[model samples]
Target: MSNQQPGWFPDPSDAKKMRWWDGNEWAVHVSRDGAVWEEPLVAKTIGLKRRSRWVWVLLALGLLVAVALLSPLVALVALVVLVTGIVGISKGSGTWLRLKSRRTAIGVTAGAALVFLMAGSVSAAMVPGETGAPTAVETAQSAEARSEATPRRTSTPTPTPVTTSREEVVTEVIPFERSTVEDANIARGETTISVSGQDGERTITYVVTVVDGVETGRELKSDVETVAPVTEVTTVGTYDAPPEPAPPAEPTCDSNYADACVPIASDVDCAWGSGNGPAYFDGVAKVVGRDIYGLDRDGDGLACER
Candidate 1:
């Protein structure tokens, strides 16, 4: 019958234990393995007999009678005592008395009813509306519930700013220039360096600004240190050339062929012939190659005509 009521019963998940059924649904509280009820730690194994409802009814009747006869103070004290006894018997003795015997269970419930009647008489003697406050335990539990329901607070973080700079080095070439000067001693179309040219050098430093690990701005910080340039001197050839020696005189044809030449036209002068006055030749073969005297009547290389 108690199991059929709107309360707890042995859990289906664990047959040896009890779980709370809060009238409409099962609650989170569950008993240990051998427990018969789910409740406060000290009373979890105790079972409240369904008949305990009769104890509360008896308490109410006793309180009514005491309030009508005795004062309100007496009635209030009696009310407190009755409520305490009912809770203890229902939670502590209910399961134990029932399991031992039905007779024992009935005896305990009747005894608690009688105690409530006796205390109700004394509480009814107190003044009306002057009942004592709730017990310390109930007040403490209320405070604990309020604390758990309240939310906690958190702090906000602040941001910090930063400044940064960077330095970098780079190099570049300075070109050297060539300079020319006239040199009459040098030959034309020829180049000679009176002084060799040299390239100039320089170095510079800069200050650069960076933000969040990235470059943002830059400026020159140091004056450029420069090496002065050495002026180059190159001699361009401007010398005039001496006139080429007069080409040698051409040789004369008379000098190259003097053996064949004749200044006097005498037949004796003919070197190829031996005759003198007539410049005669017995045969043309005898006058071969000696016509310088012009004594040949025909060009047969003969000296004279027949």
Candidate 2:
């Protein structure tokens, strides 16, 4: 679940021991001494438990065979070791086991395996032959014969030395970094620099290591920022929406009289010359609906003929 690799990790179920994280899922294998295995004591309802039980049975049979063949003292020690290993496997399912890196767990497992092999070898040596034990002379002759039967390996040739030139680095003061501050009152999608930024100069010395005319490593020896960087102030726009237009006013005689040019009660002259007069009225009293306020008393269509 975490970035931790597939290996021994502190068990979420139990704090005292480690559990195996198989990259994607938590495996049944748990360990107290870096010897991880699926728990045997778990219920058979689990598929992993059923599979792991077979492995345990095979190991038990192997130990029994070793016990039957080896001498009493050797067999007793092997049996004790085998039993201890089994007990270790059963003890708390890794309660008190600390998590170790995969590399460390691997090393520990390799060491334990080496010890097991050595114990088995000792048991084999202690095993009694069917015939009487071989005499020292016969033992020596057998060892000689075996040595002669095996072929000896020739010595390997030394590798040729490679020619390479050492790398060198030349350092000088140069510009490095600059910072910027924002101002949000400007119009959206617009940017303006308030204060210009100046990059700081740094004096650095480096050691470049090369092999076979190819650069291999570059390490800094000295770095001194001679000038401090100047921060640049910038104004960025925040207002983006367009403003709304005002609504139109209602048309009336006082507001739109110039456009209407209709004869009203305030008209003093025949033509009502204060504002622009109607252009289409004929030279006669006009009849518009039931009102006749613009009475020319003449038959012309112009209601207020001058």
Candidate 3:
């Protein structure tokens, strides 16, 4: 109301203002919100359309039913139906299926049915399908979990065979605790090799050739002759040299000519001559004289046996 008031705000008395020391000049409007409040040139309009979810839903289900009626043909028709439904219905675009209003439902359904029928009647169509695929990742994960949960036992393997031979030799010599043996001489024929040693390390490999039981000569593998607390039985006798290694018995029948009933000849081994007996070989044994004359041509027992 004062005529002498500074022209700072519309109503200087009623307005909230921050007077600042602008260093060299007075600051103008200092509020951040006061920068710009542009006028909206054009207004947006949202058309009021009814909930067309039932519309899209009905359309998708109808398509599915039609497809069931027409297997392969249903595919192209179904695809066209989906696209048409999407374009025709504005409200149900983002929905999983389509719905139509009582008003729009008739048109939507008719368009869908017409297109579906045309596509189906004209051509064979291919359909996208899912079958025989490997199980889902979750299923596989479940199987893995089951396997991990089950208790498992592992089996131990049998040991492989180990072998040792007599004709072994060594070069380096090791000294052993010298132990003396009672000098009792006995006659011997051949020799027996007795080995003695430390816990694991063989200290002696003394093979003495004894005639009967008396020592004639000796051979050593390693030098540390650990004469174990051995009760040495020196024999003045001979061992029966394995009874001269018995000879092998002669074979009664040739392995290649094996047959209980036939002599080695033709396939039948049948009666070859006018008076010859039936010559054949079965697996069973045949006695020459016992079998019928026509039965045993090869002198085997059975007659005409093949």
Candidate 4:
């Protein structure tokens, strides 16, 4: 649509290439190959000057066809494009009638726009929400309505209640896990080994079993994962201890000897001795049950014999 220079001229550097000047007394040319120049189309006629002018007709036709095939909503959009194309096609040139001011062209465009929009709206409104069937909301409403419309049937099918005996209900027996054993040199007395876990506590009543610090049986009341349930565990020992040698009859001095040689079972070499002792190394005797006592000092709870 633009050329500022005059007629065709050979580009000084190349004979095949060309430069042109517009006819409005500017320096330009009219040529594709300077060998045979093309006469420039005058800009006075809008459509004749540029390739874009031709596109409007094509665009308007395409839009018109689109409007016909699509729903009103989409058709409305195509219609706007078609009308705008029509105005642009006029090219603002004076026709057989008169030249149109840009403003007048714009107004004409807007008017055509309003008309098509109205047509599209009217058409879309008639379209149904779905395939004529009600939506979930509507279907629910209809079902409710039918329920109210029908008369109530007082007698209905009654389901028989089935009873199951304890033996019939297959029980899921829960297995117990023994936590890590926490053994240590325990003083001679009753010690509570923490029997934790829900199932452990529940089945862990009076008869809670502990085989080598492991729970063999228990009823867990809570989930096995949480809750601090106390478990009664009995750590039965392999050996037992007897009552302390009845406070040995008062140690007596040998009638002719300077001091009493009567044996005094002092807990030396035992945990009570803090390294300070008569230095006499002996053995240890571990007692387990209430009535059992042993004198085997090598951690072997036995009686009498060292």
**TM-score per candidate:** 0.31, 0.23, 0.14, 0.19
Mind giving the per-residue lDDT tens digits that candidate 2 earns over 218-305? 8777777777767766667676667888798554332212223443444324444444443333233444443244334464544455
Q: Which candidate do you rate higher for lDDT, 1 or 2? A: 1
- Model 4 clash count equals 24
Model 1 per-residue lDDT tens digits across residues 34-133: 5444444323233354446567678667755665566345435543443443333444434422335445554544444454445444444443465665
Indicate the worst ten consecutive residues by lDDT in candidate 3.
39-48
- Which sequence of candidate numbers ranks them by TM-score, best first? 1, 2, 4, 3
Whole-model lDDT for model 4 versus the true structure? 0.42
Which residue ranges in model 4 land beyond 4 Å of their true spot? 1-50, 75-306
Report lDDT (CA) for all predictions: 0.54, 0.52, 0.43, 0.42
Off by over 4 Å in 2: 1-169, 172-190, 207-219, 239-248, 252-306
Clashes of each: 14, 10, 24, 24
Assess the local accuracy of residue 197 in candidate 3 as a C-alpha lDDT between 0 and 100. Answer: 35
- For residues 32-87, write the lDDT of model 4, one tens digit per residue: 43255544334434545456545655765665565556546554553544334343
Residue-level lDDT of model 3, residues 205-291, one tens digit each, is 655565544556667755553433433343233434335777997664323332453453323334433433234444544453433
In model 1, the number of clashes is 14
Whichever of 1 and 4 has more lDDT, that candidate is: 1
Candidate 2 lDDT at 106 equals 38
